[model samples]
Target: MPSSDAPSIRPRRLRSTPAMRRLVAETRLHPAELVLPLFVREGIDAPRELQAMPGVRQHTVDSLRRISAEAAAAGLGGVMLFGVPAVRDARGSGIDDPDGILNVATRAVQQEVGDALVVQTDLCLDEFTDHGHCGVLAGDGSVDNDATLERYRSAAVAQADAGAAMLGLSGMMDGQVAAVRDALDAAGHADTAILAYAAKYASAFYGPFREAVDSQLTGDRRSYQQDPANRREGLREAELDLAEGADVLMVKPAMSYLDVLADVAATSPVPVWAYQVSGEAAMIEAASANGWIDREAAIHESLISIRRAGADAILSYFALEVAERLR
Candidate 1:
């Protein structure tokens, strides 16, 4: 062991007190760095609570407006809207219709919150498709990548026209970012940004999300989404999206993939985001309800850890609650 005169460097000095910790904090999370993902189902006259996601609900257009207003008041970074259409067709016609539930909800939220909060919409067909796939299926029963790109192009333009400030490209289809970006620019919506779910993995964590959207997906997303065991592939996906003009790159199921999030953040040329998806939120809520853990503290700790791991922004189910607390 060392000589007493050797400079005693104690790292705990910064951890001694709350004020000291705050003063020396390496990473901090703020309300502006969090985006709330909201679900609005068509034909619902009132908010319907999701059984799987205890505190979350499928809201009506009016309820969406009210919630969006609260988000703006809480100073949230943005709101990502998912629509549960009452009807689904082979071509996902609802996705491109100006009167589509998602488009309608986007216009309502924009009118309610204006520029105070960024109003974003989920630019995907899974919720509107009869097959429950993110894209069109080929004659061979495989997902037709090219056809899906065409659908995404139309969806992006429609969302822009409906007042979406940002488009969340959640479908893991190849060339999606480039296709949607081109469509937006061609339609003179160059200012509309794309949040690419660049490294989304095929995991069971999406179960609750499927339930929330009333998805009828019969098969796994392994054919499109990345493999859970591959880290290098995740980086490659992120790199490709950035090169394709994605304004933000995201990794899904944030808690289980903090390593991937950190890797993406370290090398990404743009902002890196993490989605704390439905299953992750459900697990915490279920455990807390059973008195297994302190819900509030656990939630804060989980979010803080994600922020410390290099997430510039987070799409969390707890966004509203956390923002309210912070405010």
Candidate 2:
């Protein structure tokens, strides 16, 4: 397709072969850049597979320990824990309970892997509140942002006490990062870091996650989660989190928000993370099961694209599997 007036430049030369492609690669995905997101539940003796998220399980305490060990041995960068409590309440008291599922899992994983992997826990109430909202309701039943910050503060301390190296503030309440950070520092957990879910959008892509976590929401999360239509708003959220002393900023539903992720990555002072949420993982798994796509190649390309989008780290369900392949 070259024209008679074409210059000497041949762009394809650098991509002509696998070796050349490797040599010119601008982005790389290493096992150490992947963080596995895990779910732990109370009163379960064996790991139960999440039907919506094939190949992903809600683990029991002992099983979670084994999985954490596997993550460390496989060289994953970290594990993010989400708890499934046996009971839920308006205040999400379980989140502050030292023996809560998430806290217990955090301690177990920290003990199991030691410094081999960074242990993180979801510092949110959605998974613990009976209403499945991130925070308590106001008098009129809307999300009470300030009240949520208080809960997050206590939750941060609990997670840190249970040995979480980092707490993921996913609630999206204003001032949450500052609340939790101040709480951690005052509780003598100065080394405990915070990963603010700065650009989390309320997307349809979280359908599978609702199943995985047994979320009890009767309505949508549009009240708190960012609207998908806002790009600059995402950047504003990141700026606010950074100002609040967040150690890392994260963009949720990575594939759909790569632009936001890239923007945050370019502007943020700390590490930027992206989450390949449950629906993304389930889509790949479902398509591969039907022979519609090459499973391994698709996952590699998806993750590579996220990394190329400027994620310093990725939290995904495929972390362990992809890590083994990378090794």
Candidate 3:
């Protein structure tokens, strides 16, 4: 303890070399641990860049195929597809239509990638509903939780039929996981898995996602999505999803909710995933574009920190870029 002059007492020794740094690194990021979240717009023949999120775009079916191919080639774990339909309705018919843009895009990507990458689709109605709610609205203009469960059941079946490997139920409606799972099994899509957004918080972080999806949300998702101030509630949500047979439980806006991520990871019987949502991505992009940070370095560090926190896989807008860099 008194060896002030000891050469071996220096803590900087391990940081002196790249190989040493690599050896001592506590967390490692791989392309296969990344899942890209993509948007496909109906009736759009061209890829349109999302203004709020720089470098992100809503793709056509053709563009989605190309992107899926690239994701597979880069060894990314999967691509989560969000549909931007040209029309919206109270019932969100587009979500259950076999020929709907998202379902079609899912099929196209599945054909293109050929089981090389997991094809996932967001099973939420917000992008397809005129009211911009994740579920049907009642007479009082409030989201109908029970009615939304039924819609989710149809959407789950439609997504599974469209060749989706996983259906992401991000709607936060009560009984959504169980309903979707039962629907999938009844439709003989026993292979299709459900990824539950178990601890999705009603945070401001979804602003860029709305822009990307061309959403017309009239009000906030506070009534359904978890309150940001509650941590124990997150665990309870995860527990409910688990009991309902969710294959994977996810936390949205990973960086701000690492505590919830850790809590879910600790006791989760299945894989625990995190979504590094649109606003989080935009903040990094905006800051980096302003020359405030090294884009690649900051992106890497952010993802590494998330991984270190406890996510088994991360869904990110930066997925492709990070995958390419990792490669």
TM-score of predicted structure 3: 0.97
Cα lDDT, all candidates: 0.93, 0.93, 0.92
lDDT of 2 by residue, 1-327 (tens): 988899888899899999999999999999899999999999889999989999999999999999999999999999999999999998899999998889888888898996899999998999999999999988898999998889898999999999999999999999999999899999999999999999999998999999878999989889899999999999999999999999999999899999999999988889999999989999999999999999999999999999999999999999999999888
What C-alpha lDDT does candidate 2 achieve relative to the native structure? 0.93
Q: Going through the candidates in order, what is the number of backbone clashes in each?
A: 0, 0, 0
lDDT of 3 at 120: 92
TM-score-better candidate, 1 vs 3: 3
**lDDT tens readout by residue for model 3, 1-327:** 767676767789889999999999989999999999999999977999889999999999999999889999999999999999999899899999998999999989989995798999999999999889999989998999998899999999999998999999999998999999999999999999999999999999889888888887887889999899999999999999999999999998799999999999999989999999889889999999999999989889899988998999999989998899877
Top candidate, metric lDDT: 2
lDDT of 3 at 294: 95
Q: Which portions of model 1 show Cα errors greater than 4 Å?
A: 1-7
Clashes of 2: 0
Model 2, runs deviating above 4 Å = 1-7
* lDDT: the better of candidates 1 and 2: 2
Clash pairs, model 3 backbone: none
